[model samples]
Target: MITNDVLRRVRYALQLNDKKMLEIFASVDNAIDENYLHSIMEKEGEENFVFCRDSLLSLFLDGLINEKRGKKEGSSPVILPAKAILSNNDILRKLRIALNFKEDDMLNALASAEFPVSKSELSALFRKRDHRNYKECGDQLLRNFLNGITERFRGTSGKDA
Candidate 1:
């Protein structure tokens, strides 16, 4: 479940307009219209807000907001999830859509990161399931990919990792 505050923060962080957000939600099957979505965003009454079920709102908030609780706040700084970092499924889907990179890009990212798996194997894995099912090699592969991406960011300081 996504709290209203979290949603507002994510909306600001992503710099997304209601229309863009509605499109993203609609693409994910949450069929909300733009006007109502906008109204929801503008409404200050948190209790009155209606968040959708399995609507990707949680995922969006998770991937976009970095929770920062200060020392004076009486709690440790919690790393809020970003809408980009929502779930493995969300992550994979976002990556696929954002990069629009062909198979070579995935392979290059892996290889550049020193991952041992070939592009073919990775492609096969992607084909096998909408989300990767890691029994043995899966976790390692994911970790390696993550490491590679981190390394790439370290080098480029680019957005959209």
Candidate 2:
């Protein structure tokens, strides 16, 4: 899935308005202007639909971590590694940290979207890339997880993944 879709889903899942969206971006010291944000949120083929890049999404996720888990005291903020690619696994990992979800919580979240998964399967998604048990997270899985979050937090699964 595209980064813009993830951004839109996350925004809807948490019911964040424009002001809160800007604040979330600012929480990690990347203060995105409202017009830029507006373009990012625009659908494809719109006059000003700008593609959301992975690095920007990474910063947003970091900002989300700060917003949900509280920033570490006296510690400077960390930016994404220059060579890092923001994969679906990374996105899920960041969400897990921000939400303080346990394994069961994650399973429940997945199940909430009618995508039941086993604990061991879920664990593989977090394993190191070179590890024998490592599993790449697919777009469908990520979409389902985001949909699950929407179901849990918004009490409705109205948005398409």
Candidate 3:
């Protein structure tokens, strides 16, 4: 999935305005320019559509964590990996943290999207790559999860992210 699209969907789901979006960027010390923000939000093939990097997406997620769940006091800042890969699993995990979803909440979110799964399957998504039970989250799964959460928070799933 496109990182820009993920950011857009998250924005819609969270009802983030331009100023708030900028603030999210600033949350990670990445205060983006207004024009750049618009470009990032622009749809693909649209004029001035800017590609959103995985690192930026990760930063946004971190900022989101700070936005939704208050930043922990006295906690050391995390050093982002050198080459951030915003995989579906990573996206889901970050979202789970940002939205403060518990096990049942995560399940319910997926279920709300009509994409039910066993607890073990959900756990596998967060497992290390070397883990035997590790499962790679599919695009469909992430899409449905995002839609479901949109419905849960925004009162409607709206369109695809």
Candidate 4:
């Protein structure tokens, strides 16, 4: 559960103004209105507004925005400081685990989709420093890789097992 302070903080971190926040929210499909977001921020707070940390994460993942806060110095202006925890490795790890695949298997799947990744490369991808590299793979490549994996693994499950 995020507090109002946290919500306000994230907005500040994004360097977003009220109008820009409204625009960003509006851009998302089926996203709540400005008032709805405001009310949530007012009531439940930032945590409530963010149902999927993964989505908020994707914005960072795509390099579309930064998620750091500014710190004030002694009687000086705010200094932008980078927050060091904005990677989507957890999401990737979870996806790989759900598919019941090892790093090599995922690499193979990615390769099958023309991603041509190696186990070592895959491991690197799971690290924070490789975010820029992963972003370069673009959403289309990631989507294709996911689609291929799910398609290949679709019928390998048994219900009530």
Candidate 5:
């Protein structure tokens, strides 16, 4: 899953405005202006569209966690290790943490998008990479999850449209 897509989906799912999006980024010490944010959100082929790097996406995910779950009382926010590549599993984990979602919530959300998933299958997606049971999440799963989130937050009738 592309970071830009993830960011855009999250923004739409949460109905966050430009100011709120900036605040979320700032919460994790990643200062980004509205113009930059908009550029990043733009369609890939659009003029001025900026490709969002993994570090920025990681920062945004961290910021999202802080925004939703509240920052730890005394400790500094944990910085994601700088990595050149980010996997779909990383994105799924960050989203789960940020939303405080339980296994049941994830199952329900996936099901809401008509993407049936068994408990064991869902658990496999969250397992450590070295674990034998770990399964790589595909783009389709993330896409469904995002669509499910949109339905959950915005309602099935497309009232938010």
Candidate 6:
């Protein structure tokens, strides 16, 4: 999924206002004003739409974790791999951390959206690439996960999910 879409969906799922969104960004020391935030939130192909880079998304995810779970004392923020391309796996991992979800909660969230996921299958999604058990997360899985998030937090899934 596009970073903008992820940001928009997450914002809706969490019922965040612009001010809160700004604060979330600020939590990670990335100060974005309302105009920049709006541009990033704009639809693809729209004039003034700013493509969200992987680093920015990474910062936002870190900020989200801090916003929801509180910042850890004496811990430094995680830095994204330099020049790394963000993937669905990265997004999923970040969301999991931000929500502080355990294995069962993730499974339940997916089930809540009628996208039942087996425990082992879900585990594979979080595995390290060279672990032999690792499986790359597909766009469909991320979409379903986000839909499940919507159901879990917003009381409803997307109409077409």
Candidate 1: tens digits of C-alpha lDDT, residues 23-91:
555543345776667555643556546553233554343222212211233332233344333333334
Give a tens-digit lDDT track for model 2, residues 41-104: 8888899999988889999998898899999887655676776779999999999999899999
Q: Who wins the TM-score comparison?
A: 2
Q: Weakest 10 consecutive residues, lDDT, candidate 4?
A: 61-70
Which runs of model 1 end up more than 4 angstroms from their true locations?
Answer: 1-58, 61-90, 128-137, 156-161
For model 5, what is the alpha-carbon lDDT of residue 58?
83
Error of 1 at 111 (Å): 1.1
In model 3, the runs with Cα more than 4 Å from the true position are 74-83
What is the alpha-carbon lDDT for the whole of candidate 1?
Answer: 0.47
Highest-lDDT candidate: 2
Write down the worst ten-residue block by lDDT for model 2.
75-84
TM-score of 4: 0.36
Q: TM-score for model 2?
A: 0.94
**Cα-based RMSD of candidate 1:** 14.6
Alpha carbon lDDT of each predicted model = 0.47, 0.90, 0.88, 0.44, 0.85, 0.87
Q: Can you write out model 4's per-residue Cα lDDT over 54-134, one digit (the tens) per residue?
A: 344333222222112222233322222354332235445544543456767777666655667666656665666546555
Predicted candidate 6 versus true structure: per-residue lDDT over 38-142, tens digit per residue: 999898999999998888888889899998889999876666778888888989999999999999999988888788989999999999889999999987788
Residue-level lDDT for 129 in candidate 6? 85
TM-score of 5: 0.92
CA error at residue 72 for candidate 3, angstroms: 2.6
The model with the greater lDDT, 1 or 5, is 5
Give each prediction's root-mean-square deviation over alpha carbons: 14.6, 1.5, 1.6, 14.8, 2.2, 1.7
Candidate 1 vs 2: which has more TM-score: 2
